[model samples]
Target: MPNITGFLFLLLLLATEGSLGNSKNEVSHGSSQNVVGRPLGNSLNAWKYCQLGWSTYERRCFRFFKTALQWIYAEAECLRYGGNLASVHSANEYAFLKKLIHQGAGSAVKTWIGGHDAVKEGIWLWSDGSYMNFRAWNSGDNQPDNYKKNEHCLEMNHGAVQLWNDSPCYELKPFICVKK
Candidate 1:
């Protein structure tokens, strides 16, 4: 029947398109030969903090800091390895970052996060040029707690459940950096 023939043709076309879509997804996920000409390392290895024993996933690198450093120094270190501190743009990403930090399993300390009110006081922005979407702050956080008026950098105090803290850019603290 001509109708049956046309239906089969349509089904075949749909199957082919599906296969193509899957191939593209695989390539994007770094499971295809499309990366042959690029560097030969897993996403974890390509991360900037691998030298510091941190891991990577899908072009993002993570690091755990036992000590604290100033924001500028932390940012410089991240730049040295082609990365900046981590920023969470979505709930899933926030969960993933929290998991990674939890894996480090160290004492609570204020660590530098990748956001600041640098451009204009009170206008926060991530180093990656993304807008501030979600903020995790503790009580009395971000209130300009009796410091100079020019403190522009942000930190996450683990003791406060990774709440935000604004501090001078030169204060030293251990920070996590992300690379892509």
Candidate 2:
């Protein structure tokens, strides 16, 4: 379930973003109107927001790239954009990401994320160095069993259901990048 605060914040962000005038995404952080029946002039608007084609949440910006690329190549592309290949710390984040991709692709497709255990077996870490405290691994038999011990990268399955699965880094897939 989505948090009420987060849901309200999303609505506020959308409403604010939709009202983008000639200035675009660089407006100073402040509220010209109340958000969710309360002033949103708090710390929530204190940081710089996202750029064009990016979505902002809690001051972070995320963009979904439709180009399919290998995991390493995808990470490189994300780096070029001044960010990482994206990391998920909670179910809310995971859901938000899935929704982000769906808004881009309009269909289910395996997408690369920033998780891997390349350094050691069973030791997963986000490419951006975020803590790997959440796992949405597909609940399939022997899922992410390091199939043939060659799968070290992570991909999210977004469809009627969303879940994570391990795959080889060489696999090409579209990816999401997060500017923290």
Candidate 3:
């Protein structure tokens, strides 16, 4: 039938295209086993060069670390991987990250983000040195409470949905890392 022939042709075309990789970038199923020997066209091409377990969204690759570590140590580890702690620039990004954390780490686990007031009390900033133009802090009188003047690192998944809280940087917690 013509339909069967057309489908076979389409498959052939896809196989050819996959064999000839694009110069821009190749998107794969996020694992070497899926990508290493396969033709580029065989991939879904979601985002170029995204490693396995790393989610690609908005031209960035995000990976959530389940290992608990101090805020400073977490930042260092992200840097080692050629990225930094995840920074939220928009509500959509925040929401995406919130879902990612909850799905990857769980809703009950507290996780450290990039925001911190370590340089100065009450002056929160992201690890990338960006000022806080967006606010998602927890409800009043509790967060950024600077308990004993020591709580300075920012974290999410505190009690309510996606609220943030200020805790001491020394506390060990899982973190999110981002790469572009």
Candidate 4:
């Protein structure tokens, strides 16, 4: 009977410790607080802000657009909505964006991603303060066509699925942006 009691006590202690560890991790991960009337750190938080749009899982915001636009205009629009164009950092993010695009959320036109070659004519950067690591450009695109010299904007053509083309900064198109 003494051994049985000791075993029960050990199990209880372990259960308690596990729960405590989960709570601590949640708090430290910056996902314990609710934002914009939605619970944080869940997929629902992504959909709660906008209708069927792209969501930044870590920062907590949904990006929306109906068409494509110039990089400058897209950035400005995101600012107006308290966010910026979506910056994809992982393969999961790339897949998610691709799925969103395929779902007709952005079916009409090629949308502007958050990347640009604006810094030094060839160096690409995302809007989220990260260096470009992954690219999804189309064939023969982003080849520095040198059409206008120093053109620095990027767009994802849905048809080609791997094309990224550069265009003038002033031309209007749809874009994605993120915000907290």
Candidate 5:
């Protein structure tokens, strides 16, 4: 019943978001009267568009899931939200994602961020079909070494500050999702 109610409310918000300005805060899914957003006149900006549990950055909405899952399952979960795993394109964006993970997980954690070379070795691509222009690979020990010939998916916070390492797609790790 709660899921239905939340879905209806989300639909209503979507239908009226343009006219109602935009929601800027997390929305409660239950019968709480303390809702914050455009309708409640709590928006700090008139154009924010990310929903509850998602953080808006530069017109894109990002969500971090703490539940550990394999890379494929993580991407699938993101796809369920009409998006794919996040793709970091710049140092600032990567820092922002790291901050989001820190806030959500309470520490640095090995998390999935959608860079993979599953199809072709030595060629990485974002799962969202975006170009792979930036990389924060771990320089120590020479990562993405394809240890055991199974490392293909990208993960961050692996033994280095904000650095990434390649891991098997079957390994479980928390993930982040993004959408415009």
Candidate 6:
């Protein structure tokens, strides 16, 4: 009889904990709420990827371009696909991209992101001309240092642990694109 009561109590606790976890996830991943019914891909299968590649925590579809290109070219390529260069908004999104890049292109690989200060020095902006409020700049004493006064494009995963670095916009490098 006592064993039955203990088992019932354990079950109740488990259910309560599960509910709490789900609630927290929902609140944390509010962007995914609208993606519940979206199809992963089209019927033709022409696109290389589908909705499954989107991170639920970030609420954006990401694609990595293995080819290296200048910042302007990279941004143009992304725009052709109805998206812009990948703009990371949160730490979770950054971490997700870091892992994804490592899995897709190997670690220590530098990839062009959407951040740039081309318009004016010291004022960073995303590809869509949005102000950059979130930052994961490398504090390694040489990053965003604008070495030689020509570094304006933002590159991630340049150093260990996916830190952001400023590089010349003309430098060719692999890039990631993001679509809504």
lDDT of 5 by residue, 6-64 (tens): 99999998888665443345454543233334221245454444566778776577999
Which 10 residues in a row give candidate 1 its minimum summed lDDT?
A: 31-40
For each candidate in turn, the TM-score is 0.60, 0.74, 0.72, 0.60, 0.75, 0.68
Q: Top model by TM-score, which number?
A: 5
Segments in model 6 whose C-alpha atoms lie over 4 Å from true places: 1-57
Per-residue lDDT over 46-164 for candidate 6, one digit per residue giving the tens place of the 0 to 100 score: 22322444443333578788889999999999998778999888887788888777777876589999999888887888997656768999887467888999999999987665699
Q: TM-score of predicted model 2?
A: 0.74
Q: Candidate 1 lDDT, tens digit per residue, 5-95?
A: 9999999999987896544223333432132112225552332213335555444556665556678777777887677877766666665
- What is candidate 2's CA lDDT for residue 85? 92
- How do the residues 11-68 of candidate 3 rate in per-residue lDDT, one tens digit apiece? 9999888776663444555444343222233446543455667776676778899999
Highest lDDT among the candidates is held by which one?
Answer: 5
Give candidate 3's root-mean-square deviation (CA, Å): 9.3
What range of 10 consecutive residues in model 2 has the weakest lDDT sum?
Answer: 32-41
User: Over the full model, what C-alpha lDDT does candidate 6 score relative to the true structure?
Assistant: 0.78
Question: Which residue pairs in model 6 clash with each other?
Answer: none
Query: Tens digit of lDDT per residue, candidate 4, span 1-180?
Result: 999999999999999878965442232233433333334465543433322334545545656576556678788788777677777766666666665555656353566777777777777787767767776655554454535685577766545554466666667776667676
Residue ranges of candidate 3 with Cα displaced over 4 Å = 1-22, 25-48
Model 5, residue 33: displacement in angstroms? 15
Please, what are the lDDT tens digits per residue for candidate 2 over residues 1-180? 569989999999988777763232334436542212111236543554455577765557788999999999999999988899999888988888888988999976789999999999889999998899998888764457799989999999833456888899999899999986
CA lDDT of every candidate: 0.66, 0.81, 0.79, 0.63, 0.84, 0.78
Positional deviation of 87 in candidate 1, in angstroms? 1.6
Model 1: what TM-score?
0.60
* All models, RMSD in angstroms: 10.9, 13.5, 9.3, 9.8, 8.6, 14.0
